[model samples]
Target: MSEQKKKIERLTGVKGMNDILPADAPLWEFFEATVRSLLKSYGYQNIRTPIVEHTQLFTRGIGEVTDIVEKEMYSFTDALNGEKLTLRPENTAAVVRASIEHNLLYDGPKRLWYVGPMFRHERPQRGRYRQFHQVGVEALGFAGPDADAEIIMMCQRLWDDLGLTGIRLEINSLGQADERAAHRRELIAYLEQHADRLDEDGKRRLHTNPLRVLDTKNPAMQELVDNAPRLLDFLGEASLAHFEGLQRLLRENNIPHKINPRLVRGLDYYNLTVFEWVTDQLGSQGTVAGGGRYDPLVEQLGGKPAPSCGWAMGVERILELLKDAQRVPEPDGCDIYVVHQGEPARIRAFIAAERLRDAGLDVILHCSADGGPASFKSQMKRADASGAAYAVIIGDDEVAADNATVKPLRGAQAGDADAAGASQQQSVAFDALAEHLIERMTA
Candidate 1:
């Protein structure tokens, strides 16, 4: 009796998690490389921590009432140990945990940066994803607003380097905890007075996090929020002084900015200056990057009290802006593509490819997708499609002569004497092939 075969089910990625296909991988590489170089130039070193942590790390550091901890976090119980764990919704809390665990502040202050994926359980949209990547920096042990201004200026420099514009800065001082307490009292009172005007989300956050109510996007509550008590008015003498000092430095450096009274960032740990770099390009999701001073987060997470300020920018959001600005970088194509057929020619092609690579050239050796060697005509088609500048061709005839024909596949490079449409070919001996290709490429 013949047994019936069971059909296999096709699997797909999780709902909001996306794949960075080959077509989009180049842009991601370009963005990451540019950010790495920029952070290095600013004396910021990289620090990477685990993607999962104790669930309490965020509930304690980011606050239990905040949206991230309450509704957006991906939390679960470890099946083996019954311990609570969460895929980090953001990097700042985890960074603080690492700094505390490692005692990184033992020697004065440290300027550190990180880049990796973050997970959030939310409906994915154009610029928002379930799994997103962020590039952030943290400067620990810096008490003054100078560290704050330096990081802000660093962001400005990155924008200029990347040739991006249309993003503007908005700054606000959350002041000290005492000052925020005073503001919170008045803010709660005011919201209660207009309790009838509050929406479901606004009413829910009215008492627990009154400052967030002022940040409501509900058009119906705009008037009530706009008329609410401003946090700036509650800033005490030293808090006002620090805020003013940051402004002076920004003005002297010619960095344009504004102060928004309702700019309480969506986190509980922030205490002093808070700022955001926002853009209109992405529609509702306008904030591309934001961070501020959290002098208490170190101690809150079990480290000795240390002041820290940093910012994190969305990699996907910034890349979208780059495309909107028509600044997408070209894909990285190899300098040479080696195409060969027949067993003897294939062996020689492998050796030639390695030699060229040893000479600091990018090369791709041709091979059949099927188990057999592809035809010469088919291989030539791939060599052209690969975007390689030159094709190193070898066949049975050339293999017997111990030679390979180097032909320009994409026309002449800069400074070459050949016309735009001309193809130039040269036969070179196997022993001197690498040197010959190098000289021609450099020329």
Candidate 2:
């Protein structure tokens, strides 16, 4: 291939991943800021773990037989020490492993939040990517239904803060490990009867985790799942009470939810209170966020059996929902654009722009050297495109008179624009352009 072609190919992002360009930065800022503020209000602290961990950590914490560990992990050996490592497919397991390694569990209950990229080797789809971003929260050491309720409430609060609409919460309890195991046996027996009709993947799931049959996308398998044993029927007394208590809390808080008995999560670690936030805006991949209780996960990863619960939401999926709902806000733009004419005027414009920026206003200083008087119109157009609320024009005439011309780019009616002509420009005494711009922008 030619060098030009090679350069073009190198510029492209890897498949199933994207570069979040300047245009998308504002949306990201809004989403992350809203989530961070909400998490802080709920008394959760931020915790960041490594992007890669020992491969065994996930194998033990997320389950070796599960899709994330068995099929989707991006694992490789470290070049330095030859230790096998894998990019995290999810945060809960890595966070659990961090807690164990650092002995955070001994310090009592901890509420933590994390936001970053997760890698999984999977076919790219509309809402699915090989690499994705997730904002998640983990509440560890609390084992009762109250902790579960708090996590659910936090999610609701996050959605409200983001001004998200038309989302439904579907929740279910998978009961304790033993109860799930008993239910799994009965589910396998049902699958055995329909073995001939089962797809290869479904049959494989039957031998490993028969409960996953209910999570199948196949309509034929779904028919079988509908009549299969419901986990709710097999919940022990304690598990039943825990599920009821969670429902009561939701009622008291006025959080609308539906009890979905077939909502067992795809992960093997989840033992109770698996839930998902779903919307109809996205076609088949409607689940924006979901997680549940994984009480034994920490212990399984060499921790002292610390109970933990958490949830993760896909950033891309949420962005899609926001776009479909027309909820994304317009980007914030420069507050002031400084347009200068002559070389001397350019220096003055730079100084004035600095003053405006120091006063907490965003100022864009134009320093092009090629244009003469004709550049004024082009500079004004650039200022307009910058979405600047105001423009400060400094030309040879203004600089000679030791004055500056400030005009409102927006928030001016037709009459106001006419009244505020060249003569109407604000006259700042000395180098007080910053104060003048601050007052005008705020107004």
Candidate 3:
């Protein structure tokens, strides 16, 4: 036998799971920064919860009959202890659980937001992944229809901020629990009459989650589903007034929307106003963001009956749309790069970089992988590729003189770069490097 054992095969990431490469980091950062700013401006506080929660949190909060609990959840027994654990499929339930457990609403209403990864067992597609990121907003202790309207307004503002296009809003109210139950009785009766007309999946959900049957994409079942009983018709007076109030608010704000009777939201906890922003841009799986009032969810999850309204946007789907529409801007690289020659020059380059960074400038220090220094030509190429506007060159001569040669590598055009170098190139002293770079950048 050989003295060395065979190497183990390299393992790959799980299917439907993906790695966010360096190329995609810019867009992710831009999206996150924009959302964080927007949510904060509107009086929302950020909250975080663990990615894994007790499986019962979902089964109880999301509803036992829902598809999330029945099929899509990634649940397993904790190996150390026999406790059942699950990778949260949707975060709303977890958010509600945290709020209830912590009594966040005891002081009054709380406008909270969260951004994190969620897992689900589903077919991996262009915009869907087993491990995906979501930005969720929750407003608790507010029962007014105004709260629902404000949430939609926030959604529209976010789309505008992202410069996204082709998204259209559609809304429908689920009314009170009694109203939905009364409609369910009629809906089931109607579906039972035409049970043979439903698709296999539709038929399966018909008895358990008849509201979801309306969301089916099966062409053969569309005609029947379209003509099925709509919950909008059975709304009580209070429900109608609440729905009208939301409509009036959207109209006043000039936020366009269509009333979609089929928009019940995949979650069973939603009651009263439910809305979704969909786009034809994402192929057949069109919804990009959606949510509504889950008035009973807090109480259902063990809190004193507190009203809540919230929504979540899928990061991948929205990014896909922004990418397709060419709305995401190309990420700019560092503002400056320091390229050096001698060991002493490299040390000086490191000091210059830190000085620039301390001055609020982003700087990239160039180093060759071979442990030997790279030639000036090679360093220049790297500086240009790094998207740095200026390359501060510190050669043996410049290092000995205690100064650096500031070279402009990028400008509006090639000619501009040459012109900038001709006009701005200088041997900047060690202490003046940061000030010199700032002056050149502004100029």
N/CA/C clash count, model 1: 0
**Distance from true location, Cα of 77 in model 1, Å:** 1.0
Model 2, position 420, has a per-residue lDDT of: 35
State the lDDT of candidate 2 residue by residue for 216-263, as single tens digits.
878766777888889899999999998999999999999999988778
Query: By the TM-score metric, which is better: model 1 or model 3?
Result: 1
Backbone clash pairs for candidate 2 read: none
Clash count (model 3, backbone only): 0
TM-score of each: 0.96, 0.92, 0.95
How far out, in Å, is residue 160 in model 2? 2.8
CA RMSD of all predictions: 2.1, 2.9, 2.3
Global fold similarity of model 3 (TM-score): 0.95
TM-score of 1: 0.96
Each candidate: what lDDT?
A: 0.91, 0.85, 0.91
